[model samples]
Target: MTHTWALVNLKPGVGKSTTAVFAAQAAYEEGLKPLLVDADDGRSCLAAYNRADGFKWPVIGLAEPDLHRKLPDLDGGVDLVIIDVPQVEDHARIARGALRYADTWIVPVAPSHYEVDRMFEPPRGAADDSGRYRLLEFFEEVQDMRRSPADVVVSLNRTNRAKRTKTGPDAEVREALEDKGFEVLNTVIPWHDDRFRQAILPRTPGTNMRRLVRELLDRKGATQ
Candidate 1:
């Protein structure tokens, strides 16, 4: 069976597309036929695929409400499907649609007050709120709709190495997430422009990306 993983979050610029690309590449290197679905309306994943010379796998754009129904049918022989979803606050329908079919939900969060606060926002307005509250509600709805708890794995991205000490932002963010009952991954992707700038290039990812992939695979194994 194809294991589908969705890169989702309530905020943008959290490295969702980059993580999706790297995760799919890692899966490919692991002998899994990975199919990357650019479910974000921004089409950043598809753009990355276009910019990368000689990229081997298929990266398709399908940001629609019926993504859950259509994605599995397009799996072909793919062993894994990595979906780059839009920011949950902006495209709840598309994100929720992808969530319904995803086996694992990987949330990429930057260690910042803005991003961390958005993660735990409460549901406030109508169904059309489209804010962080609505985003949280969508996740709950997906759990009920699928009749199973969502397997959510949080990753701290764009971390600053200089401040990785006990009182640093990275540690604080991890503590906050854990306090809220979130399972934050130990592998933190540090903030490095050189590596991130080469995201669209057909080159090997940095150590953090590789470690993130390994952590994800290990988590999947443990869950199974």
Candidate 2:
């Protein structure tokens, strides 16, 4: 069975693409044949795959709004599928389509007041059926459609080391999210040097990403 995971967020630069790539890499290291689907029209994930010299997995760009339908066709014989979804604010249709088929929805959130504030607001002028609505509605509609709630978790990404103190942004964001009844993962991706941003080389999974992969697998195992 193919375990499909979607990395989604309402705002940009939240490390969605980076998380997708690193997660795929971690899955690969774990002896899983991971397929990366770049569902974002920006094609950032696909571009990263293109630039990498020795990336072993198959990465395809399916930026169309009908990704839910097309994704299954591409999943044959794969152990895992990691989807890099577009920002919900701009690509609601595509994001909605991806959510319909996703088994796990991973939300990457930066520890910032603005990003956290944007999480609760629906996209302006968005229809109720759009991805923006699904995001703001906290996947309630998608859950209703599937007859069960999706496995969703928030990953705190690009955290500053100094801000990890009790009263810093990381703690504040985690508290706020927990107060809102969201599950925030303990594994955090810290703000690294420029080398972390460059995806041209085959990346060895970082400690944070390895922990994230383990958490994801552990959750999937417990659910099973």
What tens digits encode model 2's per-residue C-alpha lDDT throughout 1-224?
Answer: 77889998877788899889888888888788999999887888888877775389888888888887899888999999999999887887888888888889998998887788767665467764454533647476566666456798999988875234577889899898887678988788887656468546545455677777888888888887
Per-model C-alpha RMSD:
3.3, 3.6
Q: Estimate the TM-score of every prediction.
A: 0.88, 0.88
Report the Cα lDDT for candidate 1: 0.80
Location of the lowest summed lDDT over 10 successive residues in candidate 1: 126-135
Worst 10 residues of 2 by lDDT: 127-136
Q: Assess the local accuracy of residue 205 in candidate 1 as a C-alpha lDDT between 0 and 100.
A: 45
Q: What TM-score quantifies how close candidate 1 is to the native fold?
A: 0.88
- Model 1: per-residue lDDT, tens digit, 77-148? 988889999988788889888999897898899888778876766665544344445456677788888856
Backbone clash tally (model 1): 0
Look at candidate 2 and tell me the lDDT of residue 15.
85
